[model samples]
Target: MARKTKEEAQLTRQQIIDAARAVFHESGVSRSSLDAVARVAGVTRGAVYWHFKDKTELFHAVREEVSSPLLARSHAILDSGDYADPLDAVEAAIVDFFRILEDCPTLRQVLEILILRCEYVDDFVDVKAEVMQPAFEFNERVAAAYRRAAALGTLRPGLEPESAARDTLAFTTGLLHLLLGTRDANGIREQVPAMVSAHLALRRR
Candidate 1:
């Protein structure tokens, strides 16, 4: 009975999180309320409060549901040191990120919420750092990879690893803005690989 209760509780928690994502995506964070989330989840308002203390906590949970997987995959790729060429690892990580974003509607919605919907003010003021932490970690990992590639004499002679890393990040940020703003998954998948390849090619020896 205890095990069944725990499983059911977990399900309810996930349902609340899913509903929060939908509500936050559609209504934006500040405008959304716990009552709305409960309605969407088909649960009592107390159920949401039982799982999350407040709207900010629930928002954090929603963000983590999507960011955690992407962060884990990136850490696995960039931290493993298993690739023959670190730049190959970098390229693979970038491509895999795009692939996941393209395949997962939940990820897309959460990303849209983070990027376009929510404002970093009032209760959300501290949330900006948490939201951006993944990007910061990603930049550090990619910079490390570029540094390793440069040591291997894989990068162009004059190219600086940190500079290359920054440039690559800029390109990626621009591409993400375009993809999210336009909701152009098909166009992104069709063109992004070649675009990423060309960007990496410029850094290669």
Candidate 2:
């Protein structure tokens, strides 16, 4: 009986999260309200309070839906010393980010919400700040990888590691911007691997 009740509680929590994403995505977080999320979830306003403290917290929870898995992979690659080829690990990680979009519809919706729907301002400032930490971590990780690659003679001679890291991140971000802004998934997937390959080709001897 207790187990069943716990499962129901978890189910309700997820329902609230999903509803929050849709509401914030459609209405934009600045304009959205917890009452709207509760209505969308078909739950009492108290249920939302039961699951989340407020709208900002709900927004973070929604962002974590995608960011958490990516963060874990980034941390693992950054922390692990066993990789025989750091370049391949980084390339695979980038490819996986694109590949998941094609395969996961819910993730695609959540990403669309993040990249297209929400604007960062006012109450969203703290949420934006939380996201910056991961970006800094990723910058350090990629910079370290480029430095190691340069040391091993894998990167083109005389290339600056920090510049290369920043450029790579910029290029990746641009690709994501184009993909999301245009909503061009069909040709995008076919070109993604080639794009990554060409980017790496320029760096290698």
Candidate 3:
């Protein structure tokens, strides 16, 4: 009956996103609906429509909300440039990355949306792109680190830096996927350190 202020509108939008995550977690993506999200958020259906064009757009928004902070942390690590060994820096980054993923329950909901919702495939691609941007940037950092290692004579002479970098990237990504799929906290604690060590073994020195 009353026009919502801009701040009220923004708050309502976030509430819907939060509620959507709850519904998604409880019932998976296919079972969740905008109407249900509106009910959970205590907002009218008209308000949800006012903020989002449709479910697809809201799904992307949820992905963005979940990823933006993780990307920012990754970017900060790259920007700070404090660590001497590039692989060491990358390892530190990976630990922090997994910790955030483990701590953020809502991310699990977001992942369910991407992986389970067969009806909205475009969101899957968009999610991949969102993930790839950071992956590419981290790959470049690894490549640079590998080049530096080779230059410092810490690596085998005449080593192919780019190839090593690619291999390291692939290895880390596999390790992360394994970590994400793993439900046991102790198992991850045991596996992640070994994975990091094996990755660092790639260093010549």
Candidate 4:
């Protein structure tokens, strides 16, 4: 075999990751094999192994590939500092998440693979931590927004930022689960504005 340049190696690695996404999306992770991914990517089994130690590592890589962009968008929204009503800013961020999911099919598929296709038995419990880091950051952003709302007297006087943050986080989690379960072709994209409105209405002064 001819030697591959570093650029060729990186391209091959990404091709394998793309193939893994398709394979994992089509067949659950436990059922999908690196050989199947290699075939899909038009690479040798040795090529797949060169880039990833095993299926588990490849799965994590696939997730990281999709997740980094999603988290970056979330971080950008949190860092934008554009909304006068911090609560409105927080709601806009959540709405933007749904818009992203609706707008990007590749991303939506990756999220679907993570949410509906994968199981977390045994060592796979660690797989969940990959999800928690952004969630924790998201929670902090919501908490900060709530604190800003409180300071501005937009929030009901007695409302606590911590409690609001926790409730909003839990609500967002439930919304995502239901959205996945329903799998409505265009689900939540339209509903988010009204939902956020009703949610914030409850806490408004």
Candidate 5:
């Protein structure tokens, strides 16, 4: 009975999270309310409060639901030391992210909320740090990979690891904005592989 109850509770929580993502994506986080999320989830307002204290907490949960798996995959690829070239691992991780983003509607919606829908002012001010934490970690891992590539003499001469990492991050961010702005998943899929390959080629020895 206890196990069943726990499972039900978990399902309810996920429903709320999924509903919150839809609401936030459609309506923007700052303007959205717990009541609206509850309506979308087909649950009571109390159910939302039971799972999350407020809209901010609910937003965090929604973001984490999509971000955690991608971050985990990136960490595994970058930290595994299995690739012959470190930049290959970096490229593979990036390719996997874009592939998943293209295929996963939930990820696309959550990312859209993070990149375009939400504002970082008022109650969301502190939420910015939480959202950016994963990005910082991702940047650091990419920088570490660049450092390893430099040591292997595969990186372009005189290109600092940190600078290369920052450039890669900027390029990826720009592409993401372009993809989300255009809502052109097919177009991005057709273009990004070559663009990413060309970008990485410039950094190669």
Candidate 6:
């Protein structure tokens, strides 16, 4: 057999992921079978196994693809640029996250898996932990941003930015689950920006 080129390997991996997304979207992750994903991708079962160890790993990969750009943009925004107010950076980050989910269905599926189906699974915590790393990092930045805002006297006296960031993100994650879980998955796109603005309004201006 001819050795597969790197491009070919990546194409196969993406094919599997795309197939899995279609299957999961149509029937949901809980009901979609690996065999069904394999058939959709027109690949062998062994190929799916070769690309991803199991459903969770595949889901994780999808989540990574969905969130990686947002993660990079967020880190860049927080780490660089002289902002008029540190809190503005926080608002920017929040707005970015809200907009990202509206644009990325794969990431939205990650939220759905956590809030909708994983509630009944024993390893739900594990799944949550695996997928929450990006949120945690963003919260860390929020905390640091909060401190900066506090130093500038722009933020309220008692609020803890770091802890608040963590809390706010956790709250928003749950909110996203509930909101998206009940409504048509794609419908949240039109509303997340306003929802984000409302949540940010809770902070002292």
Q: Scored by Cα lDDT, where does model 6 land?
A: 0.74
**65-162 in candidate 3: lDDT tens per residue?**
87777777865674456966655666677677666666777765565555454243444444456546657777777677777667767766666878
Superior candidate under lDDT, 1 versus 3: 1
- Return the candidate ranking by TM-score, descending: 5, 1, 4, 2, 6, 3
What would the per-residue lDDT of candidate 2 be over residues 10-129, giving only the tens digit for each residue? 999999999988887788777889999999999999999988998878888888888888778766765567766567666766777778777877777777777778778777766766
Tell me the RMSD of model 1 versus the true structure.
1.4
Query: Whole-model lDDT, candidate 3?
Result: 0.70
Pairs of colliding residues, candidate 3: none
Clashing residue pairs in all predictions, respectively, total 0, 0, 0, 0, 0, 1
- Misplaced by over 4 Å in model 2 are 77-83
* 2 or 6, greater by TM-score: 2
How much lDDT does candidate 1 score? 0.90
lDDT of 6 by residue, 82-164 (tens): 67777777777767776776677776775665455444355344777766788788888877877887888877778878777
Among the numbered candidates, top TM-score falls to 5
List the pairs of residues colliding in candidate 1.
none
* TM-score for each candidate, following the candidate numbering: 0.95, 0.89, 0.77, 0.91, 0.96, 0.80
Encode model 4's per-residue lDDT on 1-205: one tens digit a residue: 3456877999999999999999999998878888999999999999999999988899989888878888788767766678778877777788888778777888878888888888876657888887667788888888888888999998888999989988988888787777767846364656777887788778788
For 1-205, candidate 5 gives per-residue lDDT tens digits of 9999999999999999989999999999988999999999999999999989988888889999878988999899987779989998888888878888889998989999999999999988889998988888889999999999999999999999999999999898888888888854676678888888888999999
Kindly give the stretch of ten consecutive residues in candidate 1 with the minimal lDDT sum.
181-190
- For the record, the alpha-carbon RMSD of candidate 3 to the native fold, in angstroms, is 3.5
In candidate 5, stretches whose alpha carbon ends up further than 4 angstroms from where it belongs are none
Supply candidate 2's per-residue lDDT for 116.
Answer: 79
The regions of model 3 sitting more than 4 angstroms off are: 1-4, 108-131, 155-159, 183-185
All candidates' lDDT scores? Answer: 0.90, 0.80, 0.70, 0.84, 0.90, 0.74
| Pick by TM-score: 2 or 3, better one | 2
How far is 192's C-alpha from truth in model 1 (Å)? Answer: 0.5
